[model samples]
Target: MTELVALVPAHDEQDGIVATLAGLYRQSLRPDRIVVVADNCADLTAEIAERCGAEVFVTSGNRDKKAGALNQAVPAVLDTLPDDALLLVQDADTVLNPGFVRCAVDALDEDEGVGAVGGIFFGEEGGGLLGLLQRMEYERYALEIHRKGNEAVVLTGTGTVFRARVLREVRAARRAGRIGGGDGYYSLASLTEDDEITKAVKTLGHRTVSPDGCWLVTEVMPTLPKLWHQRMRWQRGALENLRDYGLTRVTLPYFGQQIMLGLGAVALGLFAVFTVIVLVTVGWQGFSLFWTAITLIFVLERTLTVRGAGRRAVLLALPLVPELLYDVFRQLVFARSLVDLVLRRQEHWVAT
Candidate 1:
C-alpha cells in the first residue's frame, strides 16, 4: 500500500518547531512518517523535533541555503519511500488546517492529471497593524486567484503535497535540459525554490492545485524592514526564475503579469505627480460628479474584496489609505526588482 511521508525543512526555527509538529499530529489524515530535516540549525530544533517523534536529518556544511538543504534531504528521503508514496513538504512555521491532508489526498486521487496540491495560506495572528494588513492582502489575493478560477498559480512554500513519481519526473526533466534549476527535485540556483519547482512540474505536463479547505496559517513579517526584505526576495526571485525559463506556453501569462506590473508602476507614479501638479498649478476645481462616482466605485471594490478577512479587515479596507500605502510600497519593491534584473544586481535572500 502507498503511504504519505512528510519533510519539514527547518533552519533555526526553535520557536515554531513544536507547534508545526503538533499540527501534523492533529491532521485528520496524518502522515505515515514524519521527518524533520533540520538544516544548518544552531538551536534545539532537531532535539525538539526528535522529542516530537520525528526522525531528524541534520544538514552537513550546507551553504546553499534552503534549496540546498532540501536538495540533500529530498533524494535521501525519496530512496526510502515507495514509488507510489506521497511527499508532503511543509514549512517549519506553518500549521495546517486539520482537514488539509485529507482534502489534498482526495484532490490527487480524484484526478490523475493533478501532480501536486498546495495549501491556501493565511497570515498567523500578531504583528499588530502590519499583520492585519497582510491578512487583508492575503484575503484579496485569494479572492483574485479564485476569481480567475481556483487554479494554483504557485505551489506555495507554506505547504504542498506531491506524488513521488512526479518528483522523479521533475528531476529527469531537469537533467534532460527540459527545465532549469540543476539536476534535483528543487533547484539550488533559484531564490524561490517553490516557484521554480511549480514551473518545472507544469513544464513536464503535470498540473498543480490548491483546493478548498487545504488551508494553513503561516507567519507574517513583523516590521517594515522585515517585510521589505521578504517582499524583495519574493519579487526578485520570481522575475529571475521567469527570465531563466523565457516566454513559452506556461510562462506567457506570467510574463504578461510582469509587463503589467512595470506599466502599473510607471502609470501610478505619473498619475500621482500629474494630480499633484494639477492641484497646485491650478485651483481646486472641485470634485465632479463623474469622478466622484468612479472613485466611490473603486473604494467599494477594494472594501468588498477583503470582506472574507472579517469585520475589522472590512473596516480597515474602507478607509483604503493604509492598504493604499501598502500597495505603493509593494509597487516600489516590484519596480526595484525590475531594475535589479536589468542591472544584474548581486543576489540577496532574506529568510522569512
Candidate 2:
C-alpha cells in the first residue's frame, strides 16, 4: 500500500481552488496529503485553498511560471514524504473523477517499468459553441490516447501520477547538472514541462502510461482567440522539447508524424488556393473530379472519426462546415508554430 501525496499548482485560481480540493477529498482512494502551491498569487487563492483543507505554500519572486513554482514547492514537499509514496500533480482548474487516482495507481503498480501515468481528460459539462467544439476535440484526443495503449508519448499536465523515487531521481539529476539546471523535477527551458519530464522518464528506461479508466474533467478555453493562444503555446513548446532532446529512435516517429501533419496542411492550403484561382478563371467547370473526390473523402473521414464524441458531435460534424473550418484553423496554428520555432521566436506562458 503506497501512500499518495497530491500537489496542485495554482496561480490566482481563487474561484476554482475550492472545487479542485473538493474533488480530491471525494476521491475513492484519497491522498494521504494534499498541498497547494500558490505561485505569485495576487488573489485570495492561498486563502481559499487553506479554507478548503489544503496545506498551502506561498511562493515569492518565482518568475519561471508554473515550472519554477513547482521547483520551489516539490523539494519541500518531498522532504516530508515517505520512500514508498507517489506524487500526483494536477492543475488547479481541473477536477478528477472519484476513481481517477485509484485506477492510475493500479496502472503504475501493475508494471515496475512504468514511471508515470496520466488521465484521459474531457471538457467540463456546459458551455457555448466554443466549448462544444473543445468537447469534440477532447473526445477525439482521448480516443487517440486510448488507441496508443500504454506507450503514451506525453504525460499531460492536466493530471499525472509519478513514482516518488523516479521524481527524486529526476531532481537529483537536475541538481547535478546532468540534465537541465533546475532545483526541482520540472524543467524551465521548455513551455511544456510535462512533455520534457516525459522525455526524461523515458531516457531513464521507464515508460509512461495513460489508463483509459482514469478520467479527468477540465475547463476549456471559452473563445477561439483564447484557444488559439493556448494551442500556439502547446505547439511551440512541443517543438522546443524536441529540439532540446534531439532526435532519438523513440522520438523519431513522433517527429515524423508532426512533419507529415504540417506537410498535409501545406497541401491543403495549396489546393484551396488553386481552387480559388480556377473558380475565378474558368467558372465551376474548371473544377477537377479528382480534387472534389479528395475533399469529400477527407470530410467523410473527419466526420466518421468524430462520431465517438456523441450524438451532438455527430450532428455538428454532419454538415462538415464547422469541423472543416476548425481543421483549417488548427492547421494555420500549426503552420504559425512551425514558423515561430524556425525563427527562434520567444514564447511566454499565457494563463487562460
Candidate 3:
C-alpha cells in the first residue's frame, strides 16, 4: 500500500486552527502523517496542532510566507516518509470530508498519469447573504473547472493531493540538467507553487483534476470587504502565476476567457452609465425596463449555478447577485492585488 502525508501551513490561526485540526483528526481515512508548519506565528498554533495529533514544525523566520514554509517543510517530511508517498498541501483553516484523504490517494494510485487532484469546498453550512454569495462564487468556479475538462489548469492549493514520487522526479530531472537546458532552471518557482507544479506535471505529459465526489467545507468571509480582499488576492496570484509562465503560452487558449470576462465587465459598466443617461433623457420606464432585463439575466445565471447547493444559497445570493456581478468590489480587489504584487507588499501570514 502507498503512504500518504498531509502538510498544512499555518500562522496566527489560533481561533480557527483548532477546529480545522479536529476535522483532520476525524477523517474516516486518516493520513499516515499530518504535519503543520507554524510559520513565525506568535499564537498557539503549534500547541493546537500537537493536541490534534499533527506533528508541529515551528519556523523561526518566514520571509517568503507560504511558499517558503512549504519549501522548508517538504524536505523534513520526506525524511520521514517513503519515496512513493503522497503529500497533500492545504490551508490551516480548511476542513475536509471524512473520505478526503482516502479518495484522493486512491485516485492518484489508480492512475499513473494523474499527478494532482483537489476537491470541492462549500462555505460554512449557513450564514446570511454574505455567506451565500461566497458559496455561489466558489460553486461557480468549481463548475467551470469541471466543465473545462482535464486539458485546463484549474487546480486549487487549498486542498490538493500530489504524488511525492512525481515531485521527486521533477526535482531529480531539474538537478540532472534534463529540463530547461541551463543552470538557472526552476523545478518550481511560480508565485503559486501549486500552479507551477501542476503545469510542470502537465508539461511532462501528466494530468491534474478536481473530482466531483470528494468534498470539503470551509468558512466564507463574514463581510463584503473581507470577501473582496480574499478574491483580489486569489485573482492577482493567478494572473501573476500566469504571467510568470509567459503570457504568450496562455494567449491562445485563455484569451477567450480573458476577453469575454473583460468585455462583460465593460458591458455592465456601460449599462450602469446608460441607465442613468436614459433616466435623464427619457423617463423612469426606460430605466426600469433596462434594470429588469439585467436583473432577469442575473437571476437566470444564479439559478443555473445553484441547483445542487440548496435553497438558502439561491435566495441569499439571489438578492446580492446583482451587486456581486455589477459592483466594483472584485474589480477593486483585482486592481489592489496588482499593486500589492508590484510594490512587493509586505504581507504577513494570516489564516484564510
Candidate 4:
C-alpha cells in the first residue's frame, strides 16, 4: 500500500501554524505521518507544531533559507519512507481544502507520467484592497490552469505532492549533472525552488499538473513594498533559471512566456507615451463610444474568468480602472526584473 507523508517547512510562523496543521488534520485522506521542519525560529512555532501532535525536525545552523531547509529535511524524511510512498511538501502558512490531499494523490496514482501534483491556490483573506486585488490575480491564474485541462506551468510551493521515487530521481539527476546543479531534491541557488524543480521533473520525462479539487489558500503580501519584493524574486528567479537551462524542449514555452512579458511591458510603455502625446497635442476629446464598448467586453471576459471567486470578484472586475492599475503594477514588476537580468545584478535571497 502507498503511504502518505507530509513535510512542512516553517520559519517563525507561530500564528499561522495552527491553521495549517488543522487543515492537514481535516483532510479527507490524511497523511500517515506529519513532520514540521522548523528552520531558525525564535518564536513558538516548533512547540506549537509539536503540541499539535506533529513531529518536529528543527534545523541546525541552516542559513540557506527555504530551499536549504527542504534539501536537509526531504532527504532525512525520505530515508524513512518507501520509494513508492507519496510525499506532501507544503508551506507552513498554507491551508488546503479538505479533499486536496486525496485529489492530488489520486492524480499521481492514476497517471504514471505525472511526477508531481501541485495546488490551485487562492489568496488568503486580509491585507485590505491590496489583498483583494491579489486574490483576483490568483483567481485568474486558477481559472487558467483549470481551463488548460489542469496542466501546470510550475509546481507551486504553496502545496504539492510528489512520489518519493520521483524525488529520488530528481536528486540523482542533479548529482549526475542531468538537471539542477548540486546534489539535492531542490536547487538552493535558484530563488524559485518550485520553478526549478518543475523544470527538473519535466526534463526527466515526467509531467506535472494542478488537478481539480486540489485547492489551497496561501499568504499574500499586505503592502506594495512587500508585494513588489515577492514578485521581483519570482520574476527574477524565473529569468535566471531559464538562462541557466537555455533553450531546450522543456524551456521553449518558458522562453516564449518571458518574451510575451517583455512585449507586454513595451506595449504598456508605448501606450503611456501615446496617451501623453494625445493629451498635449490633440487636446482632450470625449471618450469614444466604440472604445468604451470594447473595454466593457474586455472587462466582461475578466469578470467571467473569476466568476468562481464569488460576486465580489465580479463587482471588482466591473470597475475597470482599479484592476487596470493593478495590471500596470505587475507589468512594472516584470520590467524591473528584466532590467535586473540585463544588468546581471546579483540579489541575495531574503525570505518573503
Number of the top lDDT candidate: 4
Scored against the true structure, residue 62 in model 3 reaches a CA lDDT of 54
Error of 2 at 94 (Å): 0.4
For each candidate in turn, the TM-score is: 0.98, 0.93, 0.82, 0.97
Which pairs clash (backbone N, Cα, C closer than 3 Å) in model 3?
A: none
Top-down TM-score ranking: 1, 4, 2, 3
Task: Report the alpha-carbon TM-score of model 2 versus the true structure.
Answer: 0.93
TM-score of 4: 0.97
Give one digit per residue, the lDDT tens place, for model 4 in 1-352: 6898999999999999999999999999999999999999999999999999999998888888888899889988999889889999999999999999999988988999999999999998888888888998999888888888998788998999999999999999999987765798899879898999999988989999998799899998999988988998899999999998889999999999989988988898899899999999989999999999998899889889878767887888898788989989999988888888899888766666
Across 1-352, the per-residue lDDT of candidate 3 in tens digits comes to 7787888889788787877777777887777788888999888888877887889987766576676777678778876767678888888778888787777877777888787787777777665766766677777776877687633355566688877766666666656754431122122344455555555556565677777656677778887666665675556655655555555443335445545555666776788899799889987763467878998897878777876677766765567545466346666555566577788775333334
Rate residue 231 of model 4 by lDDT: 90
Clash totals for all models, in order? 0, 0, 0, 0
Lowest lDDT 10-mer window, candidate 1?
A: 141-150
Worst 10 residues of 3 by lDDT: 180-189
Q: Which stretches of candidate 3 lie over 4 Å from their true place?
A: 125-127, 149-153, 170-191, 247-252, 285-298, 317-327, 335-352
What TM value does model 3 have?
0.82
Native-to-model Cα distance after best TM-score fit, residue 181 in candidate 2, in Å: 5.0
Error of 4 at 185 (Å): 1.0
> Which structure is stronger by TM-score: 3 or 4?
4
